[model samples]
Target chain A: MSTRHDIAAPPTEGGAAPGRPAPATGPTEADRRRRARLSRRWQRDLRWSPYAFVSPFFVLFLAFGLFPLIYTGWASLHQVELTAPTDMTWVGLRNYTRIFDDEFFWNAAKNTLMIGIISTVPQLLMAMGIAHILNYKLRASTFYRVVMLAPYATSIAAASLVFVLLFGRDYGMINWALDQVGIGKVDWQNDHWASKVAVSSIIIWRWTGYNALIYLAAMQAIPQDLYESAALDGASRWQQFLHVTLPSLRPTILFTAVVSTIGASQVFGEPLLFDANKGASGGAEHQFQTLGLYLYEQGWVNQHLGRASAIAWTMFLILIVIGIVNYVISRRLRASS
Target chain B: MTTTLTKPEDAAPPVRKSRKPRAARAGGHMHGGPIAYAILVLFSIGSLFPLVWTAIAASRDNNRLAQTPPPFWFGSNLFHNLDVAWTDANLGEAFVNTTFVAGVSALTIVFLSTIAGFAFAKLRFRGRGALMLLVIGTMMVPPQLSVIPLYMMVAKLDWTDQLQAVIFPSLVSAFGVFFMRQYLIQALPDELIEAARMDGASSWRVVWHIVFPAARPAMAVLGMLMFVQTWNDFLWPFLVLTQTGNPTVQVAVAGLGRGYTPDQSLIMAGALLGTLPLLLVFAIFGKQIVGGIMQGAVKG
Candidate 1:
């Protein structure tokens, strides 16, 4: 990282004064000669200074951001025992093969998808609804917007803890509210379905407002004439909404969908903190163990770096596919509309 | 729906009959009467309930919290809970560590990304377009997927258990650079750079004098986003800082809740303590935060 300082290296003699152009004439007086030299230096510096200016991001990215990902791919091909450095064995595709056969990996992947779908679908729909409401001439709109985003500002650790307590079996508020409506006791932690719902609820609670605000911004950008034209065509309120607003918000909807998908697949802290007794296992039976936590459990907890690297590569591949699909869909939507 | 306003231009008026011309009244009840307010207020209460409950729980003892239909009012145990969280849960050390890490990291992100953003937006250079595209492309690849190799890199550097392990990797965010670049492209004019050059100002001088000051607002938004993100960051820190007394606030809060024999009151207090700084930030910069999100969403 100390190499980052080189980005601000002192300008060379020919690069001493940047951003100034060189003189056109060859022969000159001493003062002119000196000024021309200085001007030439500035021109040279200007030619290359953008590289210097942008080096920090690349330098840091190379060291910390990109290298780790590449190293993970390399390590995934080898059986590197973390505790015994000298015992590394070249095992091509074995780790990936083993992961394919591992139930925990599949389980974690399943839970990740389940929670991702359950949490993201409802959350996005609700956000669109809320954004729709806020897009109107509401009273105290700023106050509502501010309050809506308050949950987003809270730390996941804190928010999940609050939810964990709220999801408690005997003394939890959720169950208490349920009981008043004649529902039975819910073992939120132990029951597999209930635990997933609890984890998803925390995510939905934390992010719905954030997505809503984004939707609202997109909604506001829709030209007023579009809505008016639809209204004048004898379209009902619902027809105008379906034709004018939803269609206009297609790109934004796709953007949020992809962003939320990436976020949902990486869900971790909530489940880890939600089940106090289970630690990173997610639950007593690993009921809600997401792929993110699975990667952690394999690498750090179990000291299986090779398998963890495999998992990391798998996640990377999954994200790449999803990202490309999202890009294509968004482009198609833009082209169509 | 029943309004007979047929003209396309006049259609905007009858839809929003009372106020705010051409607001998206595609849905019925666009005027948002008391019922809309009621629904919005209900959702707001639901959104705030957890934080409110956390505050209420933080003031109460574990005995009261353990009761069925747990105590909903404030108790006299606030001091005790704070003390327990500070000393027993090691939240004080975590607080200091998180503040140092988040503060320094946010500052670095703002400074570095501002320069890089200016360069990307205004500078003409070889491979500038390719590099910009590369930076944006990396945004799709999340750090979580590379956590394993990142851990190895830290281990090779022997930086595990050190704050640098957490802070260094986060100093330059692609999203921050992208955001700042997008903002600078719109906010800055090439004429300004050209004028500075005509006056024989060095590139560095031009950036510092003309660009930095002009980009301060965008820099502030990037700084706030970075600070909040770093402060809330969990998984990376949780992996690196295995030592007990050296945890960040979020990790310590996780530990408080992760244990089997956890004290509910202490966990509540820790959660509140961890969240207080960011909540204060939100209170002051709520509008900017919303704006930042919209900007990212629109461009993204």
Candidate 2:
């Protein structure tokens, strides 16, 4: 096996091929001994350096990340509340059982999945298209790329609030524009499906640019030779993209998909802001409620600690399952490739 | 490497032919071609319209805003609305509180992430591989899962309703550390550190002088992300900052929509104010923000 030095190149070094350079001359005995000693010292340093470097992350994770996760699992098994005294009572699986029967829980789960599908499918497809357009030679490409990320960089609270005004039924700019173009105003926040659509549009707008940039990077990494080969076969631009580029982007595609799914599952701020009229219930009917919002309302608003903890664990489980599925699919794709 | 040398000849024809259409279009003076400049101009306007509208709405009275085709021009109610929002919601307090929380949280995050990142990139220690994986693995665990437990922990510590509750939980971010590490590893050279070490500089001194300056670009990017995230964060602050006067901008904005019968102009004004700093940051460091985001995304 190659030594650690062989693998120490930065990932951005363009994956240089190995075994090309040969030593210029045979080493003298003294030089060989010095080199061997240096290598041994380097190996010793390598063994300890990585651990010291990564300790903060693990330390912080243990306190903030892993500990909280384990605590949530423990909290899920008890019947508790915010104001209730901390008494040890473990009703195993009862929290999960209650979740199955809870109408709000199911609504939140269904809404999460619905919004996930609505946002993820088009958001990614459009992102792929945008990335493709972006990858081509264009004037002011840098400016456009910068402008594209503005929405993502902007605060979610701010964007959702802007959308709230834009999607207003009576005096919204969108309705005003639509009226000019001979279209009628639509009630954006009142109706269940309409509100979801409105909320989903915000998600799509904010994230499409981010994912597009990711895809653009992956696209840049694809070998120019592959496109050249396809072109030599009399392939059109579309053909080259479909045959050479899209397949090359599968890993990134899966990555973004899983990440988007996780994001969608926890869709909070938009729905929270959008349903501001209903006072944090995520709508009067809870139509636009998601798992994250539901969890918040339960834990903080209603003070249903046990149920909220259960919902959180369930969301975590779902995310893990999705992540595992994504991993499996990516591995299969890699193996096949 | 072999493929790079061999493919140029084969690749030449298609690229040359593909250029023909663009050249033809340019020659024909097709000013508004399918890839129209107009579309770009329109989208830019669309992207910025809400902000423009907010300014107009903020300046207008409720009467004017309630007009059929809402007043597209400004009116003389900016001070009146500001006064009402201020007195009604104590928005001024919220602003101060928010600035404090976001500022402190961002500073701490930058400090911790930098120290941790430098160590990860340069320091030699045991169990580094497992620790690195552990940190990376935490990235996959959604924040929602931990919210409940974190809230409970905060409650146990009696830190609920305090700004520390908001700032402490947010101080450690995986992405911040990851980005800082990546940037430092790439931007800083081993020779600089070796020289610093030869000069009898301690590890901390070497990092403070050498690594920190080299990591500014990445620090700016991480700082921007953290600031925007903290400023805009809604759920945690909303939960912890149950006190009306202590609300962050988001919680305050959401309260505006809730406490009053949803006034478009007021909400627009508030939202506009909330988003202005972010927009300003983008405007100032638009290039850096773009480069950082693209770099971070690419690596991810």
Candidate 3:
């Protein structure tokens, strides 16, 4: 222990030497010349290496990312479809205008937002609570942590299909359980709100554990000393959790929230599978059609590529705004922390 | 002070006195505590119930599954459903095509991202920071925005319905590059590269010998993630691989539900088969996958 302590102490002293050079002992002429040469070489290498290391990303991005985004924006301005390619015409802002007037578009937007809020809030809260439990001294912590991530890893398409069976009205296990509890069977697919609820439940089920594990990791990083101090001061577990754990987890929470929002906004597979019986239009009335499904319907099903591209751009803009708002909030929270 | 108060239970337990107090406290906590556990267990069951149900339902005859208060237990029709799905959808072809597309796409993404990420993390050149910023910036833009243009491009190239359409467009993954860059930044120390250089190793040699070996774990994580993403992907595959014979797994499953009253057992069997590889991948690399996600979250 003494040897280890001795080894660590000299690093601080050595670091301080660079900060405060010994008087009249800074450098000899040879040392000065050698230092200057070394510094110039180091600067040159630093300048070259970073660019060399980072150029491939830029090259690929220019080709794939930037060009595609610009092209999408351009495509959105034109009136185009899959079949009538020869009838391409520029229709400025018409697609966007159509989206505002379209009831189906509005319904999709509403469903997307509704599902986003319904799934993300409960998912986050459950994650936080579960993480708190996991953070405590527990046996088989690693096993639980690994097990929790299973739903997230499961294929979305497969999970959605499974969920479709589970949410089936007559013979599904969910209804059977509900029947056992004296509740009547819900026509999960027939009702709009129930369908939305069922879809959101799938999202929450898959993601809650993943988010909880993340929160647990963040919780583990919080100093045990803080918890001890809180305990000594007569703070209950809940109180300490509220005051310390929540505040400490603010950034991670915000991150999950933003990601959840982005993910939710693009909710497609669940609703697609949920309404597959309705020709993948999300529902007969388009009740559960999210923005993502709307985009899919416009682009693929109706072959209205221009309008679909417009919706995609609109989604992108909304995501950017939400992301910026999230960034601002996260920064403020981090500053306070 | 805190240690002292909590230490009594650890040291010599004062038999009767300690037992009584501890048991009382434990009992009080337990009544309130099991609620959380109950809820969790319930949700866990709810979460896995569908998968379990699918397995059972897939094995049951149509008549059995269609019965009221559906049979929770398995029946002897697994092969029947499998045979139906296999012959009906020609899933054997779909599976091969899906595997080929996913495998090629994943390998391409790994190769491209690793090289690109190594360049981004280690090589110092002009516009390095700007390029990285640009790559990270693109991550926020949903892929939906570009699907139209991408569709147009594929159509113009006569690549629509071709495997290349699926494989090529997904080659440049921003998240993969970012992930690999982060991993490389930490794993590949400057000293190691400097040492390699000092020993007269060329730049390519330095990267291959010094950097690539250190990046295996990160590469594995990236590979697994890409594999799962590619395998499970529906939208792009559905759009691009529109040919009847070349349908991907998800596309094939979607097609299964499109015609006449869909065969529930057959569909479930197909879904289960489609998800099997993903489940296996997760089972094996669940820790690294979770770790990679958490690491990305922290860095972001």
Candidate 4:
């Protein structure tokens, strides 16, 4: 032991602290075995702990996310009712075929498209303008951002209800303001186009600031050096924005567009809570009904789970098609740029 | 555009360099113009006007709301209307139920996400890449696709109107995982973890002592964001929770909007009650949330 210490202690103490605390117990037989076991356990922990860390998310997601998605596809093939979800009879493509012929389904899809365009086009454009303004140096920027996000903080139910009061045909503050401004009073709920506009306005109010904030984030992420270099080259502010800011923000713009599109396609609460009498129908003539509301009406109101599943699947397919289209367009744009 | 230039240092040991704000940036010290302020003020007013109107409508009687011009100012009937709507719509119970659910969901999601995010950001493991891709892919799957089956599960398990109906499904968030992973990848230094390991710290010890402290700021931000999201979530809670039996704030407020009471003031009161909590949260945590969103957006 003394000879081994003479050989090992000098080397160990050379790079270590002036005096080693202790010998850390001699490398006796049991100690070596214990050290080996500890290393094995350490190696095992290193290799497997990551899986353990990530398993809960995977487990929950598989049960809640993936399984349900595939099951919805399965349930779409059978005749099932809400009253007895266990009961199933094979219907082949009857549900899909019926959805194709369903006039209300077509109308709902068309309204969804209309509202999506109405809300998204104006919203993104306004968001871009607002984000540009926000990116400028300002006092109390946080206050402005928080205030702008008020509508996002407001729940869809609450926002829709407040909007319903504001859009009242006879007594609404909006109509009164319009009258004061030399415009005639208009029926917002009863008129199909008016209802669509009002509903789209609610979406715009809720989301424009959020998208603006997102755009602002993207803009801020762009280094000021880019702008400085552009300025050195005598590029005007507009030119610099076009050349530097917009290009850097391409991915962010695409992200927001995809998110907003998904939101619009699955818009359920605004139209659901718009008019009480024609709640699920979206209006008296089902004019403002979206595919989401129509699905709810089919499954919950009419108790036809099978049909609703079909509708759900149809919406999924439509979203996939839209996603692919978006991808292709974005790719083409990227290549051209 | 400058990302390529900066990408090298990103993989280097943490620099601990703080990012300069836009005002401090050399070239662009210019403040906003008058037109910019005017537009921003206009937008802010537009953003806040509906909420203000809700209070005004709630404070006045139903008749006042149906008049030629809506009430533009507060009236004495605010508390009376609030009380009536509170009981009428079962909002008290809703507040309790929603708070508990949101709190539990936020806490669990934060905890789970941080660990998983650390794993993804720092650790080398099998299936990490594929798993992360799956998480991102899952974000694209709309809730409509899952709700039908979830509804079935809730019904079959006789969990209708229970908090777990909303809480369990919400315990996992793809965005939360992604957000935390992005934050940790930059926030945490590899040298720190290695030092801890050199000190004979186990992975568990490294997580508890090293990772958690480094991750605290992000954890707080994520928790608040998740709380707000779960609090405001409508579709699932509306389906499972009944208005009278058990309700979330969204469900209860919706019940009021469904014309349970024909009084418009009462409905406004409920809507105001439902939204006030979140607005207060936003008011207090506004800066942190703003920072968090910007941080998440950058390099995300």
List TM-score (chain A only) for every prediction: 0.88, 0.85, 0.84, 0.90
Interface RMSD of each: 5.9, 7.5, 8.1, 4.6
Q: Which stretches of candidate 4 lie over 4 Å from their true place?
A: A1-26, A330-337, B1-17, B26-29
Tell me how candidate 4 scores on lDDT.
0.85
Best by lDDT: 4
Better of 1 and 4 by DockQ: 4
Among all windows of ten consecutive residues in candidate 2 chain B, which has the lowest summed lDDT? B23-32
Maximum-DockQ candidate: 4
lDDT of 4 at A74: 88
Candidate 2 residue pairs in backbone clash: A48-B124, A48-B125, A49-B124, A49-B125, A50-B128, A51-B127, A51-B128, A53-B120
The true-versus-predicted C-alpha distance at residue B59 of model 4, in Å, is: 0.3
Better of 1 and 3 by DockQ: 1
lDDT, candidate 3, B14-85, per-residue tens:
322433353243222313355556555665675566677778888986667666788878888888887787
Q: Order the candidates by TM-score, highest first — what do you get? A: 4, 1, 3, 2
DockQ of 3: 0.24
TM-score of chain B of each: 0.86, 0.82, 0.84, 0.92
Model 1, chain B only, scores a TM-score of 0.86
* Candidate 2, residue B93: how far the Cα is off, in Å: 2.7
Q: List the residue pairs that clash in candidate 4.
A: none
Give the per-residue lDDT digits (tens) of candidate 4, residues A1-337. 3232222222222345233234475557775565556667777888899998888888888888888888888889999899987788899999999888999999999999999999999999999999888888887777899999889889899999999999999999999999999998989998989999999999999999988988887887678888888999999989988999899889888888888899999989999999977899999999899999999999999988888889999899888897888889789878978
Cα error, residue B26 of model 3, in Å, equals: 22
Q: Write the per-residue lDDT of candidate 2 for residues B85-174, one digit (tens) a residue.
A: 665555777788888998888877887788778777766565556666666777777765787778777778888678888887777688
Distance from true location, Cα of A245 in model 2, Å: 2.8
